[model samples]
Every structure is written in C-alpha cells, then in structure tokens.
Target: MKQAVVIGGGVVGCHIALELAERRYEVFLLERHSRLGMDTSTRNSGVLHAGIYYPADSLKARLCVEGNRLSREFFDRTGVQYRPSGKFIIARDRSEISEIEALRDKAIANGAEGISLVPQDTVQKRVPCVRCVGALHSASTCIIDTGDYLTTLKTLLMQRDVHLLYECPALAIDGGVRVETPRGSVDADIVINAAGLYADEVARMTGLDDFTVVPLKGDYYCTTALPLEVPVYPPPNHGHGTLGVHLTPTCGPDVIIGPSETPSRGKDNYDIETPFAVFDDSLRDMIPNYEAIRPSLREGFSGNRPRAFRGGTRCEDFIIMKQPDSVIHLLSIESPGLTSAPAIARFVVKMI
Candidate 1:
C-alpha cells in the first residue's frame, strides 16, 4: 500500500481523501482546524451551476459539467439535500441582451442543455419584480445544502477507516518533508495541498515558485421567505478585479442576496461585517428586486472566495498543477469549485 498525505480538510481535500481511500491508498488527512469544511468551503454560496458561464474549452467548462452531474448523483445516493431549482440571467436593459445571447451560445458550446433566451414579456409575467429586457434561462442549475453535503463527505471519509488528524496544522514542508504542529513530522510519497484559504502557503512550503492565492470575500444575505421561486442573476460585470452581485435560493427554500465582491488585504480575513455602502450601491442596484424582495427583509450572512487577484481569473477554470517531480498544488479554486469538487478530486488523484 502506498502512503499518501492530503493537506486541508475542506470539500476538495476531504473528497479527494475519500477517492484515495477507495483506491486503497493509506491516506492521512491533516487539518489545522478542528473540523472539516470550516474554512472557505463552508463560507460560499451553495450553487450547483448549470455549466453555463466560462468559455467552452476551459476546465471550468468541462469540470463544472462533469462535477454537476457526478455531485448530483452523489447527493442522491448519500441523501444530501440538493435541489435543481433552476436559474435565470436577466438583462435589465437592451444593452445586456447581446451579452445574454452570447452566454446562451457559450453554454451550448460547453455541452449544456435547456439554456434559452427568454423574452422580456415572459419575464414581466413570470418574474415581474425583476426588470429585464431579456433573460437566459438554464434549467439544469440547482442548489445544494453545502453544510449537509460537507458533513456527509466527512462521515464517508471516517467510515472508510481513513486517518484524520484534526487540530494538526502543518508548520513547514521541504519536498515531502513536513514538520507538523506539536512535536511531529511526516514524510510521504504524495502530498495534496487543498487548503482553500491558505493553499498558497502550502504550495510555497514545497519550494515551488510563481503563484499567489488572493482571498476575495463574497458576502451573502438570507431571508426566510422563498420570495422568487427561481434564482436571479444579472449580466456579469465586465471589469478587472470585480464581480457583479446576484441572488440565490438555498436548499431549504430561503432566498440569499449576495456574494458581494470584496477583495481581501491579507490572510485570516474572515470578516462577515456587512458593507452597507457597497451593499447599497452595488448589490441593491444591480438586482433591483432586492429593494422590495422578501429575502431583503430577513437575516443573512457572508462567505469568502479564494480567487486569483484578477476578476478574469474567476471566469477562468480552477488551477490544478503538479510539480512533475512531486507535490501537486490546486490554486484559486472558487465559484463553481463546489460543483466541480468530485471531478477536481478525481483529476488530482489520477495525477498522483
């Protein structure tokens, strides 16, 4: 049996550990925190995207599609709460109609189905609160109970008899040589760095150069009311280091207004304080219904996205690079990352 180590206990790390365990590799999962998914994975919008967005050729295009199918199947088998609520990309004005059409074409190119251009008249009758000249409707989209999904993955890992070391943070790494916290060290033939928030530090410790993990905060607001039955999205903001705010409905049927774009200055910045100014100008303005929506009238929270410094990076696919000699690093894994979790894990396991 080959001994391997996976660092980081988030969704990617835990899911990969489960895959490795299935393949009979003696796997040890090391997490700095006491529980799994306690970091960035837990702090995200539980969106199972419909394989829209992104150019057809990218991994975001491929992995997202594969991940969505596989994750949905897994959820069914494991009894995780996942709902295919469907979503719409609304164009509030004629200026966005062209872009919405382009996205429909792109989704087709990416091998996605049921993506159509919805007329403004239909939008007025179906979703009057949301003003739009046109909208892209993708029926393949769904939302998952991310918390329940993570807990299930953790339970699966433990049931497999895989070793899990909680509160055991890695202090240093020289190749496969790692000096973990307390009075201990570990050497293994394989090491995977999926430390969502701190994935950059894990990579640097292995002596690889030329990469940085920029933390982008995505704030969310929640309401008890299932205001709009379908999720509402706007034409994405076409700007560097920026992203547009959208609305999402949770698995429990509550609506979430959110994921505001707030870039982080440094590590350990898990601040959830509401940015009243940004929220007022951007979130409320981009999605007009937010002003009078029932979700806006309820409680909410925020999460962080481990994004690359540039906004273009978010549109790009998740980065999984192996050192060739040894040590594999998964960087800037955000957005559809949760949707791409299983496929990403399988890809990394094969690389190993």
Candidate 2:
C-alpha cells in the first residue's frame, strides 16, 4: 500500500486524510490536540459561505462555491445537523448600495447559486428587527453544527482504517518524506502540511519559507434578544480583515454577534478581550433595535484566523503549494475554510 502522512487534524486535514484513504493510500493523520477541530475548525461562525465575499477569480471564491455544495451533500448523506437558513447581506445606507451591487455581480461570476437582490421592505417584512436600505439574499447560505460535522468526518476516517495519532505534534520534517513527531519519526511517500496556525513553521522546516501566518483574533457574543430568522451581515470590510460584525442564527436558540477583528497576541488566544461596547456600536448600526437586547448579550467565544502574509501584504486567496519532492502544504485557509474543506481535500488528493 502507498504510505502517506498528513499533519494537522482540523477540518481540512481530516478531509484530506479521508480522501487519500479512499484512494487506497495508507494515511496517518497527526493532530497536536487530543481531539480534532479544537482550534480554527469548530470556533467562530458556522455559516457555510455562499461564495459571495471573495474576489470573482480568487481561489477562495471557486473553492467556497464548490465546497458549499459538497458540504451540504455530505451533511445530508451522513445525517449531520445543519439548518439551511439563508443569509441577508444588508446595505445600511445608499452609499453601501453600490457595495451590495458589486457583491451581487461577483456572486454571479463566482457561480454562487440562489442569489438575488431584495428590496428593503421585503427584508423588513421577514426580519422586522433589522434596518436596511437594501439586501442581498443568499438562499444557499446555511448554518452548520460545526462540532457534529467535525466528529462525523473523524468517524468516517476511522472507519476507513486511517491511523489517527492525537497529541503527536510534528517537530520537524526532513526531505519532504519523513516527519519527526514527538512520539516517533513517521516516514511516508507523501507528506501534507495542513497545520492551521503553524503552517508557515511547517513550510520553513522543508526549506520553503516564502510566507508567514499572522494570527488575527475575532470575538463573538451570544444573545437571545434578537428575533432574527437568518444570518445577517453588512458589506465586506473592503481592505480590512473581517466581514464586519453581524448577527448569525445558530442551530440552537441563541443568536451570535460581534466577531470584532483585532490583532491576536498569540495563536492560542481565545479570550473575550474586546469590550462589549465595541459590539454594541457595530450592532446598533446593523439593527436599529439592538438596544432592546443590549442587556441580554453574553460573552460567547473567540477564534483566531490564520491569515497568510507574503511580502508584507495580506494574501486574500488560499495557497496550496506542492514542493518538488511530493510534499503538499495548505496555508492561510481562514473563513469559508470549513465550508470548503471537502473540496479542498479532493483538490489536494488530485495533485498527487
């Protein structure tokens, strides 16, 4: 049997391992944590992006559109819990209407399905609490049970007899064929580095150091105050790092808000450091009746985004690099990553 080793056990790593195993490769999945999806996978908003936010020709746009479809199909086949609750990207003022139009056009170019521009009155009738001049309704956007999804993927890999080593961190790599882990040295014909935050460090081990992973922290708050029917977002932050603070309906009763973008002190920093007032201001701008639920807000969770930077500029597209010696590295896969995990896995295996 062909031997393969995959580092990192997040959603992307797990999916890649599964795909390789299906192709008759002996796969060894390494995870630093005791379990999978403990880091960037399960944290933050679990919304399956509809490929609307990225540039038209970017890898993120193409992968996200394909991933959305593949993910929903996987969830349906495996009985994963997810709500096909659509999304509304609202324009707060006339100035932002142009932004919405641009996003709509980009969505069409990216081949995102079930997209349409809705008038303000239609939005208000469905979600009376939200205030907007216009909205881009995305019927394909869905909220997923992230924990369940991750668990399901792990189980599927296990059923295929893939070796899953937990708490086995990769300390070094030599010649792109052997990985030095704390437990022992693992040798394989092919090595895949899907280490989320430490992908740059992994790349450097193999003498490929062209980029760095900069960790950015985003904070979330949960509230039962808003009667929102679906996920709602403002226009993209443009050049900024986030998609702006907006409301998202979860699989549960609580609605989540405020993933305020801030410079992370470290990769493992998951504290709710940002004050509630910042979320309060952002919420007030999107939903005029936010004050009614201001008192109901509670400290939720925070997740770090492993943003990739090359030559001191933020890389907006996902980077999948293949070294000459049968080593593949997946770097800077942030938002839409969870949605695109399955498609990313298929792409990675095809590279071999």
Candidate 3:
C-alpha cells in the first residue's frame, strides 16, 4: 500500500482522507488545530449551494453539482442531520432583475436542477417580509448541520483505522514527498495539501510557490426577527470577491445574516466587527420590515477565506493540480468548497 499524507482537517481534507483510506492507502491525516472543521469549513454560511453562481466551465460549477448529490447521499446513508430548505435569489428592483435572469441562464447552463423564476406574488407569498421584484427559486439548495457532518466524517475515518494526528502542523517537505512535522517526519508516496488558509504556505514548503493565498474575512450576524423558512440572498455583487451579505436560515430556528467581506492582512485577522449600519442596510434592502427587526440583529462569528492569487491577480476558480513530485495541492477553495468536498476527493483519488 502506498503511504498517503493528507494535510488539513477541514471538510475537504477529511473527505480526501476517507477516500484514500477506502482505497487501502496507508493514510495519515494531519491538522494544526486540536479539532477538525474549526476554520473556514465551519465558518461562514452552511448552505449547500445549488451551484448557480459559478461560471459554467469552471471546476466549481462541475464539482459543486456532483458534490451536492454525493453529500445528500452520504448524509442519508450516515443519518446526518440536514434540511433541504431550498433558497431564493431575490431581485430587489428592475435593475437587478436582469442579473437574476442571467443567473437563471447560467444555472441552466451549469446543469443546476429545480431552478425557476418566480413572480412578485409568488415571492411575497413564499416570504412575505422579503421585498423583491422577482426571485429565482432553487429547490435543490439545502442546509446541513455542519458540526454533525464533520463528526460523522471523523468517526468514519477512525473506523477505517486512519491515523489522525491533531495539533501536528506540517513544518516543511524534504526529499520530495517527506512531510516534516513537530513530532517527526513522515515519508509518504503521495502528499495532498488541503490546508485551508495555510495551503499556499504548505505548497511552498514543497517548492510550489507560484500562487499565494489572500485571506478574505467575512463577518456574519444573527437575528430571530425576520424568521424566514428558507435562505434569502441578494443578487451577487458585480465585481466583488464575495456573494454579498445575505440571509441564511440555519438548520435550526435562528436565522443568520450579513457575512460582510473585507480583505485582511493575514489569516489570523478575525477580530473585525460587522457594523450595525451595514447589517441594517443589507436587511432593509432585502427585508420589507427592516425597522422592526433591526434591533434584533446581533453579531456572529467571523471566518477567513483562503483566496488564491497568481502573479498578483485573484484566481476565481479553484486550483487543484499536481506538482512535479506526487504533491497534489488544493488552493483557493472558498465558497461552495463545503458543498464540493466529496467530488473533489474523488477527483484527487482518481488523479493519484
């Protein structure tokens, strides 16, 4: 059996480890933190995206759709708690209606299922408090109990006897595929770098430094006032790095809003606050009864996205490639990464 070393213990890394273990590889999963899914995987929105927003030809578009299916199946088989609550992309005015239509066309091109444009009456009937001219309803979108899902993956990996080392950070790589850690070095036939925010640094340790990871911080706020049954989102920002601050109904009763995006100097910069005015503005723009719910909005946690840049230019697509040695790197896995984890694991397994 070939020895495999998978770095990072986020959803992507966990999935990759599980796949490798099933293939009978001597897998050892390494995580810098004491527990898994503590970073970008558990932070931000837990929505299982319908794969509507990405460009048709991108890896995100393809893997997200397939991963959605695989994730649902995995949840069902494993009895993981998830809700297929669906989603609505709202157009607040005439100017935004065209963008919604364009998104609908793109969803069709990307093979996203159960998507349709609903008129104002349907929008109002579905979500009375939401103010929008029209909306794109994606019935396939869902929300998962991310904690439960992560626990399930860890349990499965443990059952397979996969060596999971927590609090063991990879310091460097020597002799091509040998991984150096605080405890000692591990020689592996294949090395997979899935280190969320530190992926670029991990790749550099192996002499692959063509790209850099830029940390994009996003802050979310919680509110129970505008209790919608499904996720509500504005039309995506035209040229921005994020999907815009929006509302997402968790698998539980409480609703979340305002994951405002801002660039950060480093990965540890999660101290920023979500301004009340910004959260209020985002709510007022989407929800009709903003004043009534404005007081209920409370600050939530923040997360950093490992956005990849090559030659100082932002990379919109995921970078899943192999180096000259047997080092496979997954960089810039931001949004939809949670939804795309299963397919990405299969892709990497096939490559190996």
- TM-score (all chains, Cα) for each model: 0.90, 0.98, 0.98
Model 1 whole-model lDDT (C-alpha atoms):
0.76
Please report, as a residue range, the 10-residue window in candidate 1 with the lowest summed lDDT. 308-317
TM-score of 2: 0.98
Deviation (Å) of 139 in candidate 3: 0.8
For each candidate in the order shown, give its overall lDDT on alpha carbons.
0.76, 0.91, 0.89
Model 1, stretches more than 4 Å misplaced?
124-128, 177-179, 241-243, 282-299, 309-316
lDDT pick, better of 2 and 3: 2
Q: What is the lDDT of residue 70 in candidate 3?
A: 93
Q: What are the RMSD figures for all models against the true structure?
A: 2.8, 1.0, 1.1
Task: For candidate 3, write residues 249-309 as lDDT tens digits.
Answer: 8877778886887777679777766566777778778877788887887777789988899
Q: Give the best candidate by lDDT.
A: 2
Error of 2 at 204 (Å): 1.0
How many steric clashes between backbone atoms does each model show?
Answer: 2, 0, 0
Residue 236 error, candidate 1, Å: 1.1
Residue range 198-232, candidate 2, lDDT tens digits: 99999898988888998899999998878987898
Clashing pairs for model 3 are none
